[model samples]
Target: MPATTSLQSLHVMVWTALMASLIAVGSFLSIPLGPVPFSMQPLFIMLAGFLLGWPHGMIAVLLFVAAGSIGLPVFAGGKSGLAVLFGPTGGYLIGFVLAAGAIGLLTQARKTARTPSQTPSWALGLLAGLLGLALLYACGLLNLVRVLDIGWNKALTIGFLPFILQDLVKLVMAVATWRIMHGRGLLPR
Candidate 1:
């Protein structure tokens, strides 16, 4: 590979690893609340997508999951191992990859759009973050129903409804952070 290409690859790898670590740290900072704990993971996941773009963001989320599966204390409340993958929150964990991909794609699309003034970047970023949040909740609710043998209503109440407002806040924060980072030219285009 050319030197520039090799250097770019190295840069991507380092960012991916950092994103994975951030996900783990976010999980560690969770507030235990029954089967589903509130964590800062969604914020990092969205940020990963916005800053790293789609492919690298997905890789980072996958790396985070893989580390947790291997018994690393990188999951919510420092829980890990394969058992966590089969637990109630597992679907949401898996959803992180999809969420990141969606957010990254949306943000990338916005970046490539003609007439940038027609649509503010923050609006696109917010939309992407919200979409990602929706996907996460969908996976979480589905898995909650299956894992807990609960009805949809109960799953919604337990997993989705409680976090809506908090997630919206997180979405705003993620968008704001992305805007600042991009504006400062701290993130790769």
Candidate 2:
């Protein structure tokens, strides 16, 4: 590869690792609420998508999950191993990849539409983040029903309902962070 391409690859690898670490750290800051805990994981996941775009963001999330599945204490409450991947909350864990991809794709689309002088819009960013969260919830709810042997109503109550408001807050925070980073030229265009 050319030197510039090689350097870019190195940059992406480093950011991917950093994002994975952020996800792991986010998992540690959790409030246990039955099977699916409330955590900062979604924030980092959204940030990864916003900053890294789809491919790299998805890679970062998958790496985080792989690390956790391999017995690294990188999951919520420091739980780990393959068992966790197959556990009740596993679907949500897996959903991180999809969520990041969705957010990244949306951001990328917006980015492509803008001129070099124009900045990303906060409303669009928030919409992308909310869509990502919705995808996560969909996966989580389906998995909750299957893993817990619960009905849709119970799954909605246990996994989705309580998280709506908090997730909206997270969505806003993610968008704000993205706006700040982009405004400061901390994020690549």
Candidate 3:
């Protein structure tokens, strides 16, 4: 039984690391659109939570950020180091951590609410994803306002305006992705 438990721990750890790496890959695959880039970071962030749950998913995001802080070049556009964290988009990075944790907690709750044989409710996942996106935008916009010394008007126009639609699409895609993966039993809740 100890061996089984240890093996399970290792399995989850592997998945956690994989999620972190995927986030890094997502950062690289980004399109620069002003202060914030259009990247798949949020998608993978939500997926990490959907699969890993609360602290583990949060840890994965932290690992990704730590890697970039240490000059691993994991941040968007091959950028790295502490400067990126203190830069215009730094708030979004923080958002990623919070959003991942929030999504994981919500999804975990949803899982606990149902039996193993029941199909998990997608509504909760959708709601969780939107909440995660909102956190990201809120953090990102706040940081953008502070870093650029811009008013809410300019910040909202440049930072939030462009992402409104794209972020929603990403949220939907994250839920859909999680549903398909969960259906396949790829990651047990």
Per residue, candidate 3 scores C-alpha lDDT tens digits across 1-189 of 999888889998999999999999999989999878888888899888888998899999999999999999999999999999999999999999999999999988778777665655678888898888889889999999999999999999988888778778877888888777777777733
- Model 1: per-residue Cα lDDT over 1-189, one tens digit each: 699898888888999999999999999888988899999998899889988887888889999999999999999999999888888999998789899999988887767664533433776888888888888888888888999999999898888877789888888888888777776667753
Pairs that clash in candidate 3: none
Please estimate how well model 1 matches the true structure, expressed as its whole-model Cα lDDT.
0.86
- Worst 10-residue lDDT window, candidate 1: 112-121
Ranking by lDDT: 3, 2, 1
Candidate order by TM-score, decreasing, is: 3, 2, 1
Candidate achieving the largest lDDT: 3
lDDT of 2 by residue, 11-45 (tens): 88898899999999999999999998989999999
lDDT of 1 at 82: 85
Q: Pick the candidate with the highest TM-score.
A: 3
How high is the lDDT of residue 124 in model 2? 89
Error of 3 at 157 (Å): 1.4
lDDT of each: 0.86, 0.88, 0.89
